[model samples]
Target: MKTLTIFTPAYNRAYCLGKCYESLLRQTNQEFIWLIIDDGSTDETGKLVDSWVKEQKIEIQYYYQENQGMHGAHNKAYQLIETDLNMCIDSDDYLADGAVEKIIHFWQKNGNKDVSGIIGLDADQHQRVIGTRMPAQIKRSTLFNLYNKYGVTGDKKLVYRTELTNKYPYPIFQDEKYVGLAFKYYKLDQEYEMLLLDEVLCHVEYLEDGSTHNMINQYRKNPKGFAFYRKELMKLPYAGQLFKFRQAIHFVSSSLMMRNQYFLKESPKKGLTLLAIPFGLLLYVYILFKSRTVKHV
Candidate 1:
């Protein structure tokens, strides 16, 4: 069995998928499988992947499903991955040179059942680290604490044990396509800490169509998903009052957008949600205003 599955969730990204494929082709180690979860791409992605599959430079698996947004694709990837370890490299992102080799070697040296898997850094296309590096003194951390406690910023590449990832499936809401991916990670943090690797494993490029660039529109269009994510965050034991309140504010705004009558009743922290009404109302109006001008590609 392969030691790792580097999965990519692509949607109408045929133009950029070749760069991702080229990076995988250049991997120094072939101990990993490339799994592509095609989230309803109408482009030539299927044909491109088929051609690459025939070349057989590395193991490749492809699955095509209805467009379910990034989080939905993540759910599908986690369910399909049977490898010992797995990592998500976005369609616009690619693995660093020798990244697979580094991951396998680090895991063999320190991987254990007590931990979920490894957490590594992500670099930009210019090869600059995107955020702060893991502290030298800390060798392990829960995904939540790493950012909340240590003040780490920006996105990091997470390699998870396939078995553990399967246990926490991201919730799929009807007519909603976005959810905080941290929903599953925070739940896992309750049970296991992940080993931290200082190595950079993936190179990221945020395109115009990427989710990060269209969050305001996402908040407006995916209110239910946002509300559900906020409710989940509110229930987290490790989450501080400020964090929970912030989630509550978003929850209220999203609930308003959805016009859910039982917003208060459904909230884990009803009192906080009630207290956040004014701020949430303002945010709701802001989202509406911003979304009107924003074009979701």
Candidate 2:
């Protein structure tokens, strides 16, 4: 079996996909397979991938599905991967030189029965670390504590044991509000602490229309985003009413920014939690004012 399976969920990224493909082809380590899940792009992505598959230069598996969003594409990757370990590189992302070789070697040397997989680093398109760091060693529970206390700070540049990643099919919460594939890593952390490699391997392009840039729209249009998170919050131990209150406020502001008046329109049902809005709004304003003051100063 291949040591690693790298998959990219792409949509209308024909321009960048070639760069990603070229990087994988040049990997010093040929111990990995590539699975490209086209997230229903209207572009010529299918044709490009078809050309690559026909050439068969490397082990590339491609699948086309209706656009169900990133979460849906990830769900498919989890199901289809058949390697010992799996990692995801975004469509607009590529790996660094010899990065895959280093990752495969690290996994072979350190990954074993006790460890689930390895966590690497994420960089910008120019190969700058985008902020993902974890301790060398940590118990699963402690990791969750860190996440709950400070929120998830790092890019989850994680590779998971294929078996573990497939345990929970991507959660398609109401209205498809799953937060990408976060719960997958969170759950794996429950059992195994991933081996950390303090090296940048993947470079993600922060395009204007990328998913990361659409937080406001997602919060506004996907009312279920709050509901899904509410469920996850309940699953955490120390997430109290205060925590939920803060989150509710954040969601409200994000919705308003996206021109989504869900909180106002659904006040009777969804706005019972509006009680937290006043404090939330005050905090938001304070932050904005502080930011402006700092700029002037």
Candidate 3:
């Protein structure tokens, strides 16, 4: 069995998938398998992957499912991964040099049943670290504390224990495709801390169609998914009042977008949701405006 499975949830990204495949080929260690969850891509993605499978340079597993946004693809990936450890490298991204070797060495030395997984850095194409680096002194921290308490920023690569990840499967809402991936990570935070690795594991490029760039559209198109994510965050016992309030505000806005008559009833923090109504109304208006602008462009 491989020590790690690098899964890519791709949707119509055939042009750039090659870069990710080539990066895997360059790995100093081939101890990981590449798992591609084809989330109903309509392009030449399937053909391209088939060619790679024929080359047989490394282990690859590919599965195709009806379109289900990023989080839905994640749900499928978690179901299929049998490796002891796993990590997600976006379709528009690739692994850094020696990344496989680094993950293997670090896990062998520090990995145990107690830790959820390893948290590593993600760099840009020019090798600049995204957001901020993990604090050097901290060896183990929950994903939430790494940001909320210690102030680590930017995009980071998470390599999770497959067993642990499977325990918190991301929920799939019908007709919605944009649940926050952190839903599962935050759940894991309740039980285990991840070991921090300062080395860069993945290099990312934010294509225009990528989720991060089109969040406003996501907000409008997937209000129920957003509402569910915010409600989950609000229920986190470790979350501070301010964080919960922020989630409440967004929850209210999404609920409104959904035209859900039970907004207040469904809220985890009804008092906070009531107080945030005005701000949420403003957010709803802004989403409408922004979505209109996107359509015009």
Q: Which one wins on lDDT? A: 3
Mind giving the per-residue lDDT tens digits that candidate 1 earns over 1-297?
888999999999999999999999899999999999999999999999999999989999999999998999999999899899999999999889999999999999999999999999999999999989998889999999999998888799999999999876787888889988989999999999999999999999999999988999899889889998999999999889999999999999999999998999999999999999999999999999888878542
Clashing pairs in 2: none
TM-score-superior candidate, 1 or 3: 3
- What are the runs in model 1 whose C-alpha is more than 4 Å off? none
> Model 2 off-target regions past 4 Å?
132-156, 173-178, 238-297
Clashes of 3: 1
Candidate 1: pairs in clash? none
Write down the lDDT of every candidate, Cα atoms only: 0.93, 0.70, 0.95
- Model 1, residue 46: C-alpha shift (Å): 0.3
Models sorted by lDDT, best on top? 3, 1, 2
Could you tell me every candidate's TM-score relative to the true structure? Answer: 0.98, 0.78, 0.99
Order the candidate numbers by TM-score, best to worst.
Answer: 3, 1, 2
TM-score of decoy 1: 0.98
Error of 2 at 270 (Å): 14
lDDT per residue as tens, model 2, 218-290:
5445545544443444344445566656566755554443345555554322443567567656644654565
